[model samples]
Target chain A: GIQVEQSPPDLILQEGANSTLRCNFSDSVNNLQWFHQNPWGQLINLFYIPSGTKQNGRLSATTVATERYSLLYISSSQTTDSGVYFCAVDRTLYGNNRLAFGKGNQVVVIP
Target chain B: EPEVTQTPSHQVTQMGQEVILRCVPISNHLYFYWYRQILGQKVEFLVSFYNNEISEKSEIFDDQFSVERPDGSNFTLKIRSTKLEDSAMYFCASSEDGNTEAFFGQGTRLTVV
Candidate 1:
């Protein structure tokens, strides 16, 4: 099984601030996704970057597959961004497609 | 955009009782999954279904738990005997294939007493 670990378990940021969240995996993965669990408990997909870099609006993510690490960047954050951000991965060796999830980074963006 | 939809946003059941959580994934998606998240805990994978059969499951998905695609547009997770620990937000997800981005539903909050 692949282990997914996230850093900065807790974060409090002022609105308009910027933050970076990191995710490290123990093994190579073919499927990696970033999700935001909102206050209401709806899991929203932020990015799907198994490798390389991708940007969506004020949020962007970069994954260095060779190093087994991924980074998510949130710029000019807003209060709506307050929630738990999770990183999930599925190992390349197994095609089961079950994602191993990180504990998540709880972010609180205060206005 | 098409999104996964789950029924009975919240369910309350007595321990030792049976409960069935239902979900309707995107029409074109082929892979379906069920994940659980305990209060203040991370999401954990329970099972994945494809081609109308179970593809993979975790240790947490014991004999008490089962999944079925009873129809073309519906996927379900049934627990034979609910336990206190079974209380959690159960999320149903789907992807086009084994190697694609998966989308999750709003989730069903199950409370077992």
Candidate 2:
């Protein structure tokens, strides 16, 4: 089992602001994913970066495996971005490939 | 894009009653999983199914819980006797293989009283 830690457990931002969230894992992982839980409780896939970087729309994520950390960036945030963002990882040694999740970072975006 | 689909977006059951949550994983996916998130808590893995059997399960998934792929397309989680603590958001997910990214459904909110 791997341990995941997400930073800045709570965040509040005005619309159009930019922010960055970080995830730190305790062990080497074969899979890492970022998810956004919307108000309706849908877990939307944001990124599946085990390493390297990726961007989609206003969201981007970077994973530095050597450092055992990942970063999610929100550029020019919108009110719709308000929700809980979670980072989950699959340990390389774990056979089942079940993800271990971190306590999410709750973001509140105000208009 | 292919995605997992869960039935009964929400459910309410009396304690001690049996409840089954259903899901349809992506057609091409071979790995299926069930995860739970209690209100204000982090998501936790419950079980993973492949080859029509459970490959791994957490301590949270005990004797009272079971999973089945009753058909080619349907995967279900059965709680024999629900308890108050059984209430949570249950998410069904699937991946093409054990090493790939798993996609999750919208989740079913189960309330046991």
Candidate 3:
């Protein structure tokens, strides 16, 4: 089993501010995903960057597989961005393709 | 974009009653998955289905739990006997491929009294 740990379990960012959240894994993984759990508890997929970097508008993510860590960047955040951000990893070699998720980073973007 | 859809957004059942959670994955998707999130806890994987059979399942999916594709369009998770601990938000997801991106549905909140 892989171990995933997220940084800053709780984060508060004023609207229009920028912040970075991190995820560290104990071992190498073949799959990695970033999700946003909305207020209503819908898990929305944000990025599936197992390695390298990807950007989506005001949001971006970079994964350095060698370091076994990934970073998510949110710029000019808005109130709607307030939610729980999760980093999940899948180790295919382990029996099933189950994703081990981190505790999550609870982001609060205040006005 | 076509997305996964689940029915019975919420369900309440007795401790020993059986419950079924239904999901309709993307029409073109080839892989399906079931996950549950206990209140205030991390999302946990329950099982993964593909090609009409279960490809894999987690320890939580004991003999009491099962999954099936009754027809061409529906994928279902069945719990033989529910328990208080089974109460959680169950999520259904589908992926274009087994080792690719997965899209999740809104999720069904199961409450076993």
**Separate DockQ for every predicted complex:** 0.74, 0.71, 0.58
Query: What digit string (tens of lDDT, one per residue) describes model 3 on residues B1-113?
Result: 79899988999999999999999999998889999999999999999988888998889999999999999989999999999999999999988787777889999999999
Question: For model 2, how does the per-residue alpha-carbon lDDT over A17-110 read when each residue is reduced to its tens digit?
Answer: 9999999999988899999999999999999999999999999999999999999999999999999999999974545569999999999999
Cα lDDT tens digits, model 1, B1-113, are: 99999988999999999999999999999999999999999999999998889998899999999999998899999999999999999999999888888999999999999
The lowest-lDDT stretch of 10 consecutive residues in candidate 1 chain A is: A91-100
In the order shown, the chain A TM-scores of the predictions are 0.97, 0.96, 0.96
| lDDT of candidates 1 onward, in order | 0.95, 0.95, 0.93
Task: Give TM-scores of the second chain, every candidate.
Answer: 0.99, 0.99, 0.98
Candidate 1 lDDT, tens digit per residue, A6-97? 99999999999999999999999999999999999999999999999999999999999999999999999999999999999998444557
DockQ for the candidate 2 complex?
Answer: 0.71
**Candidate 3: global Cα-lDDT?**
0.93
Return the DockQ of model 3. Answer: 0.58
**How does each model score on TM-score?**
0.98, 0.98, 0.96
Task: Point out where model 1 deviates above 4 Å.
Answer: none
Q: Against the true structure, whose TM-score is highest? A: 2
